[model samples]
Target chain A: MSEKHHIIQVWFFVGVLLLVYGFLILASGLAEWSHPPDIVLAELHAPVWWGALMLVLGLIYCIKFLPDRKA
Target chain B: MTAMMAWTVPTTLVHLSAVDLGIIAFYFALVLGIGFYLKRFANTGEDFFLAGREMTAWVAGLAFVSANLGSLELLGWAGSAYQYGILAAHWYWIGAIPAMVFLGIVMMPFYYISKTHSVPGYLQLRYGSATSALSAVTFAIMTILMSGVNMYAMAVVMKVVLGWNINFSIWVSSLTVGIYVASGGLFSAIFNEVLQFFLIWFGALLIPILGLIETGGWKGMVARIQQNFPGQDYTHAWSTLGRFQDNPMGMHWTGIVFGLGAVQAMGYWTTDFLVVQRVLSAKDIRSAKMAPIIGSFFKMAVPLIVILPGLLGLAVLPMHLVPASSLQPGQYSYNEVLPLMLARYCGPGLLGLGITALVAGFMAGMAGNVSAFATVWTYDIYRPFLRKTAPDQHYVSMGRWCTLIGLIVSIGTAYLAMGFASIMDYVQALFGFFIAPLFGTVLLGMLWKRVSRAAGFCGLLAGTLSSVTMFTLMKLDHRWVAIFALSPKAQGLAQDMYQALWACVTCVVVTVLVTLVTKPRPDEELKGLVYALTEVAQEGHTSFLHRPLFWGITALVILAVLQIIFW
Candidate 1:
């Protein structure tokens, strides 16, 4: 049982990785908010939208599968 | 196919921003981290090859689907959608769904209950060593060659899309995949594949979403297709398949049904060890059965991302894309549809994510193939043929070494692919030679107890040789498609279908004929491997929702609805 506890679930790692990526992308989105890149539908701000979506997803995973939580 | 596409684009498509590079770097770091973290657990041969058989249905199922979601398939099918219209969805639907359901409900029990480490290992139990040896060597060669093709293809795509040098892209990706797979084995590959499943979905999903938003809706897109290419039924799946000239793919309904839906699909989803190894890692018999059923659901949804983008490209791209045959300097081919779609809608950070998704796809594809090769090499080829009495630790060490050596061979093949582009087409066709024939052999071995050992080997040999002969004839004279496919106008895709169907038919015929003359394996020796002779574990009052059959039926119903809707 202790040996089982030593193994990290794949979801937890996915969560943490998503969280870091989400933060960086979200920051990039905000940084370019006033002057968005010249491309199709720049006004819609897809980076911000997709970045926030990733953030919420990451938080849900991280909270539910926190490494130290009792199984 | 993307593998057969010659890289002729002189100009780079897009340059990655620092944020984009960072996202890709983080993904690499995380995969490597997972591999090192799992190194302690992969100490035994079982753990290395099969993840200690402890994966949940969902994990195994996602990895199972993701193993085939290579960038080559994604890009190729997406490009095919652009070129062939909604008909390309047939590959995702009828070409896949039935085979997956059959695998889960009918085949998984035999594989799981027998406790076989690999598909060839199962063959060894049913037939004698000759059949298993043929299967193992063919599978190993196919996987290694395929891994190389994917490695080279990814490097070419990177150079075309991101301005990276081909050698740099090849070495970086191959070395990364090699390190992780060698260190953590199947566990690392599965974990990364599951992650890749998410990356592919999230990264590619926006195209369809944003594309739909731009094109209005399904109805609007259909209208645009009709408006753009008038009188061309690019929006219907089955309606245009009535005649050879009716559809862009130049395929008939019979080829679509028997060749693709029945033979090729069964051959691939049911028997390919590259994907089957994931299901073999399930925690229980139920999980093993449930895995492919779960995978079918996700596979059905892939067209929303892959096929939809290509259709959108047809409806919305500013310039007309040419086919690869007529492609020239500075001209974009249909194969560039996905990357072009990525550039059209994605901005800085999101662009990075999309590019990383493609990179993840390529790397994960290479990892899955290499890992499967290592398992087949260590267990089926190396141990059985060369050193039969080695310790478990010795085998595990050999698996790791084999993983590295396999990557080196794959890298060499990648260079070979660079020199001779036509080899990719031949290799892909050679792969086709095995799948449908092997499916026939495995199916007979499982269902028919009277089949002899000699019958299995002879049937497989005859089937493979016939496929080779047909491919060679078709290459030597294009008119051979008329003879093999029974139509003068049958295209390359049609030739593939007819070839697979004939090969499967030839195999079944030869096996039955040989079985009559040869001595059969005794019933006592065929217990767990053959169908009715085996004692299957009962589910024992399990809820209907918990049963694999229930989900299999549900998936089939959904598949029927999808075909009708797209029809």
Candidate 2:
């Protein structure tokens, strides 16, 4: 593939990853909605660990696939 | 209790006079000295306003921390801890770290990529001059409102601590900041901020330490809290999710974590020129990028300095000593609690002056905000439209003039804002209403190639209007409920989180959808657009969107996980 096309694909992939991550959060919140964590854990509110994992995966994709400046 | 053991209020002004004056003089001399020392740097517009873009990351980092660490926070956070238990920390955990990292890694890169002198200048390059002007005007108005509130906070602190007339306190605090800012512009502002940061840190730490010792140490204090406030969950008190309803002290984790953390984070870290100006004024992209990261690390430690003391005060003092009204339901002005504690507890000696330094710490924060407003107006607004080709010296002179104008405007605004609940609350709510939506437009314009200027402008207008509509509706609903004798808690969680969630979502959706419909700009205009991102290049990266992108993303994930586990 051409360079421009490759760059476009990378961005598209990253967008998909973010969308998935958002969905995961929505699901977790739904699962926990009825039985809210105790006040201690409730203050945590969202699933930060899952969020962190998704963020990490997204970062890895960016590192491997995203374009760098050409000298 | 024996008469000798009973607490007695100081009956004579003579006891407080020397220490109070000494504190005032110390503050005046330090700020003024900074202003004078940096006078030569203010010989030109760039130097006066942007520090000639020569600031290192460390300087920018320190200044950024100092700018945000105002008295409101010093007072508010401590009040929060005392009232809410540990859950109050949710404010710092949820809102601060994530938001700041987003700014440093994501937004800062965009600014560096744009190579714009000011945040509004980036808007101009991406959208058009009109949009840029609108953003600048919006920021200026919001900043004025904010600085006014900050001024009020300083005035109130001074009034309560020293018994000065409110008007006199406002003038003295506002004018002292104005004089230095007017004298040396950003240079003096930064220099003074560095000094203020140290003073604020010292003062914030000292009060809690002293109070803890006086209360018979941690064990005694903990026992007192347990005995006095029964059924109070210790874990919840320290938990990040603690809500205001949970604490008799009137602070809620929801407001601190979500409201202050998410909303304030987006507003201040992303949009506020005062903080962003520190990064923009850096000598290069690397320094700019590093500033917020380092500054945020420093911000993380502030709880130790500010919050612990308030908690300590709550433990040591009797209910009779602290009036019931002061700790009334839903009326904890965390800011007032500190000075009140000091007045009640501090004895005649050097320790008294040290506590006075906490007041100075508060003043320093106010000064930073004042100077920031001055810089934004002078460089982004005045110089652009009023005098296009003015000499450097003339621009520098204008900067000083602008600083004076900012101070005067802020003082007037501060006096007007006092009737509102808490200054910090008012400022944060106002910022959410005004500035948060703008972040969406700016972020899209920088990252996406298809986002047109017209689309960006339309998106901004739509996002802002929608967010405001939602906010108004929520307020109206709350008011109606109150009229019907309904409790605030009955209004529901959605109403509370409405402003932050919708404001962020609306801005993103509007910008994206509008961009999809609009035609992209011509290729020629887009040539240099990507260069700003490229100039701050990673050596090992083979393309524009390489390792740094992933590194930033990975960092976000780690942060999220940590938040989940610890928070």
Q: What is the C-alpha local distance difference test score of each model?
A: 0.85, 0.60
**For residues B322-372, what per-residue lDDT tens digits would candidate 2 score against the true structure?**
222244543335456666665554333222343445555556666666566
Clashing pairs in 1: none
What RMSD value applies to candidate 2? 15.5
lDDT of 2 by residue, A1-71 (tens): 12211112223243334334433433454465566543222433333343344456556665675655651
lDDT of 1 by residue, B1-567 (tens): 122223434566666677987898899999999999989988888899999888889989999999999876667678778877887788788889999999998898899998999999999889878888899998888888788777766875676677666777777788889999999999999989988888888789989988888889888888888888787777889988889999877889999899989998899899999999999999889899999999999999999989999999888888777665677777677767888888888888888888888888988889999999999988888878899997899999999998989988887776654443222233436556988899999999999999999999999889988998998899799889889987877766677888999998999999999999999988989999999798887876999989989999999999999989888
Candidate 2 TM-score to native: 0.75
Model 1: DockQ vs. true structure: 0.51
TM-score of each: 0.95, 0.75
Worst 10 residues of 2 chain B by lDDT: B1-10
As for model 1, its CA RMSD to the true structure in angstroms is 3.5
Per-residue lDDT value at B31 in model 1: 93
lDDT of 2: 0.60
- Alpha carbon lDDT of residue B39, candidate 2? 68
